[model samples]
Target: MKAAVLRAVGAPLTVEEVDLSGPGPNEVLIRVVASGVCHSDLHVMEGVLPYPLPTVLGHEAAGVVEDVGPGVSALRRGAHVVVAVVPSCGRCRLCLRGRPNLCTAIRGRPGVMADGTRRLRLPGGEEVNHFTMISSFAQFAVVHEAAAVPVREDIPLERACLLGCGLLTGWGAAVNRARVAPGSSCVVLGCGGVGLGIVQGCAVRQAEPIVAVDLWPQRLEVAARLGATHTLLAGQEDVPALVRQLTGGGADYVFDAVGSPQTAALALSCLGRGGTAVLVGVGQRDASLSVPITATVLNERAVLGCDYGSAWPQRDIALLADMYAAGRLKLDELVDRTYPLEGVNEALADLKEGRALRPVILPWGDS
Candidate 1:
């Protein structure tokens, strides 16, 4: 198999021929069909998040099952599946509570697979770390069966890949975490792939005056096409003030999809009394945001942290697939472009430069 290896921090990923071991017990070997170039992946590449070197760094992906190891009864060879970044151990307290997104068993270490073994190796036999359990940047991935959410074959793998992370996180943040109610005012901070999904999710819930914020006019325009009733340029306007004025006070629900402390603070500032601020973006591990204690207490404002949109991959992915198939969700519209695996760096550059939205990577050439 060929995989892109990140050997050092702040370095371009090198495409090289790598060897992949067969799945271990309870694992599934998947042939990567498509993966999305996500901001989280860029964070890893830019050293915003710490991961060991020489790692395969992609998590948002969909693939076809090539084989299944022992004890993997839920999936079989030839099944179409989307890989979830976080794996759920059914016995965990969080998983048992129906919050698999916060499964304690898989919250910390992200560089290795379930069994604590590296499945990928360089041609010269050096082990390469796995990123987020599913290294879909490669041509093949060996992941725990729990990470593979089987999807309908009718859904295209390219679009279905978005369900693994960006789309799920954004949409779930609104629908599941914040529970944006109908007739409520909603504001999303950022207009990238995840932000756009939040906008669409608010739309689906019939939220009024959906406001999309971003530094780029193009992204704001795309957000409007998807669901945003209004758009605001980040630098040109006082975002929180404008949102407050537009919503008559402040938005009932504000989502920060940019993941920076600044955006997180802005999201909270854009919330009305009793409104909820949902943080969906992943910033530096040690990043901190300061909040006004008096306002939070007096105004009854709430701040919520969301991981992968607080979604259950098995259920949410299927629901998203159905919604896409039925035309209620706009998966195709979120995809700005596609790239071959060799162009992975270029795709990442585009994403970082805000030149593309949800660029799909075809590990195998687009057929």
Candidate 2:
């Protein structure tokens, strides 16, 4: 199978015909249809997040199940599914408590079945690691059955791919983590794909006076079209002050989708008394965010981190799918452009330019 391999940090990806193994027990082999170029992948490429090099870098994806391994009963061949980055051990304490996204037992290892062996091999017979436990960048991927969520047949594979990451992260932050109530005021920092999802999520729940913030005017425009009741330029000297003014003091909930200390701090400040601030973005490894301990105590502000929108694949995927089917969640408009696998660099360039909402990579035939 041909895949875009990240051979080194700060280097261009090379296309290579790699060898992929068949599925093992509890694993599913998927024929990759489409994958989204996410910022996390770029982070890995640029060394923002440290990981093994020569790994296939893609997590947000959707495809058709070509085969399922022994003991995999929930899925069948030819079934349409979206691959999740967070592979849960189902019996873990977090998964048992209804928080599968927090399950970390399956991470930090090479891409192998639970037996600890490599699945994909290079042409020279060397083992190549998979990224995010999904590695949807390749022509085919071997993912755990728990990581593959079955989606409706009617939904386009490209749109369903977004739900695996950006959509779930944004929507889950609003509905699950922050639990923003209807008729409440909220502010979403950064109007990128995830931020836009947060905006739509807030709107779907009827969160009144949704404030969208971003430096780019185009994203602000898209955010308004999606669900933002109000848009902020994000060019002001003090964003927190602007947010407070827009919501008449402060918002009931604030979301930081950019994941930087600056944006996280701003989101924390945009919250009203007793309001909650959810940080959904992953910051740099050495980066740390500081907050006023006195101010947090005085105003009773709560700051929290949201992982994968706290999504439970089996249930949340279906929930978002139903929302998309019912027109409550907008997926088609979220796509900015599509690129062939060979044009992955162009797609990443578009992403860095802040010119794309969600750039999807159509592996082969879709292009």
Candidate 3:
């Protein structure tokens, strides 16, 4: 099987004929159909996030099952599924407590299976690492049955792939983590794929005066198209003050999809009394946020860290798929373009250059 492998940090992914292992017990083998290249993957390539080298990088994907391993009664051959990055083990305390997004079993790191073993190999039998345990950069993948979340066959896998990560992160942030209430005011910092999802989620919850902030006017325009009541091009004016004015005093919530100390500070200033700031983006590996202590105590403001939008993948991924079918979620619009597996680096370049929003990788036979 052909796959894009990151042999070193700050290097381009090399497409090679890699060897993939069959699914073990309670696992499923999927023929990769559509996979979304996320910013998180870019972070790994740029060394913004430290990851093991020689790994296949891709997490957001939807595919069809080719075979099922032992103890995999929940899925079978020909079943369509979305691959979840966080394959929560139900027996873990976090999963049992309804917080599978923070499942402790995997320990929030990838490159290995649940049993902590590599399933990929080079030509000479050198072990290759897996990214997020759902390396969909290849033509096929072997994942735990729990990672293969079933969706209605009616929905196209190309769009459904976004629900695996970006869309799910944004949706879960607004609806689950933030618990956005109807008529509430929201300020979304960043209008990338995930930020747009947050805007749509807020819209579904009836959030009034949705203010979207982004450095790109093009993205802001798309944000407006997808339920943003107002769009602010970052650095033009006092964005914090404008957010307060648009929300009729101050925003009830501010979601910083561009994770950084700068954006965190901006979010801190865009909040009302008792408002919350949810950091949803992945910044540098050593990034740290500095919150104002006095203001936080006096104004009762909060700074919350969001991991994949605090999502329980099984439930939220399916719900997002349904929401899209119901015309409430914007999936097709979020996809800026599609690329072949060999064009993985170009896809990442487009995203980094702001030429695309959410680029999906397809099996264009260049693999």
Number of the predicted model whose TM-score against the real structure is largest: 1
What are the Cα lDDT values of the candidates? Answer: 0.90, 0.86, 0.88
lDDT of model number 3: 0.88
Ranking by TM-score: 1, 3, 2
| Shift of residue 67 alpha carbon in model 1, Å | 0.5
Measured on C-alpha atoms, candidate 1 has an lDDT of 0.90
Q: Would you list the clashing residue pairs of candidate 3?
A: none
Q: How do the candidates rank by lDDT, highest first?
A: 1, 3, 2
Which TM-score value belongs to model 3?
0.97
Cα lDDT tens digits, model 1, 1-367, are: 8899999988899999999997988899999999999998998999988888889988898999999998999998999999988778878788888899988675435567777788888888898888888888989999889899999999899999999999999999999998888999999999888999899899999999999999999999899999999999998999989998999999899999988889998988899988999988888888888989999999999989988889998899999999999999998888889999999999999999989988999999889
lDDT of 2 by residue, 331-366 (tens): 888897888888888888788789888899888757
Clashing pairs in 1: none
* lDDT minimum window of 10 residues, candidate 1: 104-113
RMSD of each: 1.2, 1.5, 1.6
